[model samples]
Target: MDYRIPRGTYDILPENSGKWQYVKDVFRRVAESFGYFEITTPVFEMAELFERSSGENSDVVQKEMYRFMDQKGRSFALRPEGTAPVVRAYVENHMDKSGSRNKLYYMGPMFRYDRPQAGRYRQFYQYGIEFIGSNHPYYDAEVIAIEMAYLKALGLQNVRLEINSVGCASCAKEYDLALQDYYRQFLPELCPDCQKRYETKPRRLLDCKVKTCQVFRTDAPSQLDYLDEDCREHFTQVRAYLDASGIKYLVNPAIVRGLDYYTNTAFELIVDALGAQKSIAGGGRYNALISQIGGKDTPAIGFAGGFERLLLALEKESIPLPGITLPKVYCIAIGDEAQMSMLPILSKLRQSGIYADYNPDKTSFKAQMKAADSSRAEFAIILGEDELKQGDFILKNLMTSEQERLSAEDLLQRLTQ
Candidate 1:
């Protein structure tokens, strides 16, 4: 029987694994440099966690989320995003009480049942940063700076930053009312989803992707106009910080985080070369999320970026990443006695933290040499009847084709150097 991978998911084959590792390592280093530590959360959590945090009216809760009931009949969902679970952990672990700030980062697969497209997957890996316990707009810039630093480290150059202010709850209420008032005339012309969004979440009307609903967005009221004094001041400070940090950005009034928890600052990193799937990363502040999710009333901000889209952006810009790793030494043995002698030398090379490769099945001298060449090792340790009897092995430089005889001790010392 033949089996196939599920739709909207993919395998990271060995040929591509190095690139993944390189990017992940770069993100870890960059995030850590900014005083952020790593945090891990379960792949699935109670379904209501997202519904409450992302807003039941949001597309993630209403459609994209993967939900099911376990044998115990409790509803659970594969987390569609990262922030809610991190907030859940912070609250459950009492991290808030331990300190005035919690800077954390996470990278893992997020599941959503949306139609698969380029760089979009039902099971896609995401890297995110969450800065908790501060409403200060400086933290907003710092969080954004982490992403910017990560991209810069990866040598990505085609991306641009776009910022916006969604305002606090009070600001959102006024903006929602204005949106309803503005979109009310086009309610009949709206798509079924936009029509529902109009009544429950008018702010979402600005984010509607449907062509019919999009026509109304051009004339829709901007969220910036509705920002209250505090929200406006916070937005101003965030921009000032970004400016001081030498980070360039455009203030896009249309930028709105899809999640319901987001408030005040909102921003996205766009790679224009990727066309429709242009946004490589995005996030914003959620001052009320902690209290809403049963934690202390704390203010926090974060952003998440997809590895799939990130890799795509890198490729689009022709940025080179680490590829398949080559072996430092390839052991080629001829005759049973020589093969046995080669084992201890191979073992010592590996114990010394060297990448040494061997193939016992290729018994013939010709086949073993072919395998050694194919392995792409820098040096080939050739063990044959002559070398085995002489108590030394011939080290041949695969690249230069230079050969020399060395005792096992001398070989180890040379390779170590």
Candidate 2:
């Protein structure tokens, strides 16, 4: 029987693993540079966590989340996003009581039941940052700076930053009323989903992709215009901090986070070359999320970026990424006895932190040399009957074709140096 990998997921083969690792390392370095420590959570959590944090009406919970019941009939779900689980851990572990701010980052796979497309997947990797215990607008800009610095480190040039404010609950309540008043006239022409969203989440109507629903969005109530005094001041401070940090951005009122928890500052990084899935990364403040999910009413902000889209953007811009590593040395032995002798030296070389490779199956000297060259090794250590008898090996520099006879101890010293 022939089996296939489930749709919407792809393997990170050896050829592509190096690139993944390189980007992950770059994100870690940038996050740490901003005083963010790493935090990891379970791949799956109690289903209610998301329903509460992301909102029951959010697309992720309603149409995309992978929900299941365990053998005990207890409902569970693979996390669709990273923020809620990190907040759950923080609250459960009492990180809030530590009397200091929590700047944390995480990287891992997120599961969703959405349609798979270019730069979109059922199982995709995400890197995110969460700044807890502060509503200070500086934390918002600082979190954004980490993502900007990471993209710069990866040499992505065509990405643009778009920022917005969703305002607080009171402001949202007023804005929702304005949205309803404006859309009530066109209710008959709205999509069924938007019709329901009219009463449930008016902000979601602005994000609808249907052409019919999109026509009304151009004149929809802008969230920025509805921002109250505190929210307006917060947005201004965030923009000021970004300016002081020398990060460029645009104020886009159309930016609404897909989740219900986001408030005040919302932003996304866009790459126009990516077409419909142009947003490479995005996040916003969730001041009420911790309290909504059973923690002290601590304020926090964060962002998450998908590695797949980020890599695709890098590709579109022709940015170079690390590839498969080649061995430093490849061993070739002409005979069985020589092959046996080469084994210990190969082990020694690897033990001394050298990337050494060998293939005992190839017995012909010519075939072994050809394999060594194909391996792209810097040096080829050749073991033949004559060299074995003389207690020495011939080290050939594959690039320079320079040959030198050296004792096994001497070869180790030379390679180590």
Candidate 3:
């Protein structure tokens, strides 16, 4: 028998660490560039909080939440999505009182108990944004643009952007009724879940993956046709912005988002090369969710990118490192006396914005030389007793395998150059 990580979990080893660092740096820079402030929230919240926001009928609340009874005998749950928690923070802090539209972003793990696959995880990470207190479709377009920018920044060329309008609560009411009426024609044929959806949330039937139920409703209504004057205007504006930015999108009427709270403007960025899990990110607007969860009524639109899926997409695209690399300097001390000399030099190098590394215990000349050779460093400052006595140091160019001896001040000037 062997001890091992549970199924669906993976250890990110050293080589993969570079990629992870890159994603973090890219996200921070891009989100800030778009004026999205960072918001850090707890991994778990009151069970009722998510239930109210995600909707009690959502798959997340009903089937997938990692819930438990806290020591106080109160129920809480590991968040399955980022928006609900962020909204809770926003409302609690009265963020709306200070800002017009609160733009926030978060990155962390979300727990789901579904059967795991290439893209799905029991405990998966997500990076997402929420734009609260803004109903204008321009924010919707901007959010889409930011997601596109992230994918483009990662050098992903094969990704596709899909968009849809599930209509507002009033409009969804109409669509849902229409869907139920249409699916009633195929009542005996729908899968078990679709059957449930037909009665509870018929719009979700459009998103059904079952082949038998996959048939588009013969008289299926497009929300576009039923959009009220306000929803219609907003959707048009969003399309205009996307067109001006030349962001390609598909108007997928069938794109009913997974969460029940989502109302209008559903979208996803998909990459298929990473088998099974084709979506890299997905989200939409929830115009009335604020009041639904006990906050002031505030309209909002946002999206969350799948962390595991995004990394997999990057792997397929071969994007370069995600952030600025470390400084190029190296430390090489030749003898016992010189090893002692490295301590102050290390302090100085760090203060001067150089990345320095050396092992005082690696006392052998061959071991030191091998270590420096394997460091992938750009330059090595070789300090030994004679060189120290001469008030000079030997500098070796790791790349060209060239060496030169110079006074300490001159060597600093040369290295700085």
Candidate 4:
């Protein structure tokens, strides 16, 4: 019987949970500082929600989604990415219609049924932020700035910011046709997957990681050259905003996002050292997604970062986490009477907001001290029957080895002070 975790899923043991908390805490603080409010949607959404937004030709919809039928035969899908669900929520509630706007930050897991590898998983965690209801290119720059700030704070340096714009629907229609024609020329030479992409979604050929297919794509149509006037202006303004904010970026015309709903201001942040699957995070603008999902037209932009990839980044960079505790007091009780007697004292210490832990086992003195040492406690409270009667406890400074005998009330006051 192989009782093991399913493939593509992992258990986060105590050894690694600390780093998870560290990254999540820093992210929460930075998001709060930027005035991005927290938002969470269900882990699964209606199958149609993703299909419409991800496009029939996108890998997420075509082959990668973990879709299932409920007892009633209603189809549901574990989200492959974060932004589409967020957008669907924003539009369904008419959140983008009123005067006020919304900026949402989310952290959670997404599922994709692709072959798993290092830095890529079928069940993966993501941290995301979306600024909805505005087409302002400056908003895109601001989101990128926040992401950069988060990465910098984590001690990740020299990240590559690749920027691009796949023109809006009107221009995409024209470009799609042109792209379809170009790939048609090399159909016989393309690998099987790329040949499928050529007929259904030509833009996807640009995403082929295969060396042979990539060589053919080098001469493919550059979407940047074909951008409509509106997309061109939006992309330019986004770059200008990035420049004013001193965010370093390189414009790569090949960055058309995987989803059909995406439009304008596409960008990816990568680390070359993170192996062949290099992107740590990436996202872009989507305008028609809201309308596609039963709401009025609303503009939106957002990005998502992978948690496994982030942990890998930290390990690669040798970023250490302060995971162990530094309790204020470690109490050791000897004798059953003293162990029972110390209960009130421990309760009071907790009520006073002092970090205190005691062993109920009434263990031996030497073993107790070893436990205290591991706790890194500043002080040790030794309670024995003799000390309990005298209305005092053996209070020793773990660091100085200094001894003291003081009334319990007085000791509490001193410790609190």
CA lDDT scores, all candidates in order? 0.91, 0.93, 0.82, 0.85
Clashing pairs in 2: none
TM-score of each: 0.97, 0.98, 0.92, 0.94
Better of 2 and 4 by lDDT: 2
lDDT of 4 at 317: 80
Please tell me which model should have the higher TM-score, number 1 or number 3. Answer: 1
Candidate 2 on 21-102: residue-level lDDT in tens?
Answer: 9999999999999888999999999999999998886788999999999999999999999999999999998997766449
Give the clashing pairs for model 4.
none
Q: Candidate 3 on 1-417: residue-level lDDT in tens?
A: 999987777787777777787787788789899999889999989999988877787787899898999888999999988888999998999899864449888888888888888778888888998999888888899999988988777778999899988777788787777767767878898899988888887877877878777776545777678788887887888899999999999887767766656777989887879766888899889887888888988889889888788887877877665443543667878777787776676677777878877867677667877787777778888887788788678888889989999877787777666
Give RMSD (Å) of candidate 1 vs. truth.
1.3
Predicted candidate 1 versus true structure: per-residue lDDT over 1-417, tens digit per residue: 999999999999999999999999999999999999999999999999998888786778998999999999999999999999999999888897765349999999999999998889999999999999889889999999999999999999888999999998888899989988898888899999888887887877787888878888888889999999999999999999999999999999999866666889999999999999999999989888988888878999999999999999998888998899999999998989898889999998999999999998898989988998999899999999999889998999999999999999999899978
Task: Flag the better candidate by lDDT, 1 or 4.
Answer: 1
Query: Model 4: per-residue lDDT, tens digit, 202-270?
Result: 788888988888887778889988888888998899999999999999998888776777898888999
Q: By summed lDDT, which 10 consecutive residues of candidate 2 come out lowest?
A: 93-102
Q: What are the RMSDs of all candidates, in order?
A: 1.3, 1.2, 2.4, 2.0
How are the candidates ranked when ordered by lDDT, highest leading? Answer: 2, 1, 4, 3
Report how far residue 29 has shifted in candidate 3, in Å. 1.8
**In model 3, where is the ten-residue run with the lowest total lDDT?**
319-328
TM value for model 4: 0.94
| Regions more than 4 Å wrong, model 2 | 99-101
Best by lDDT: 2
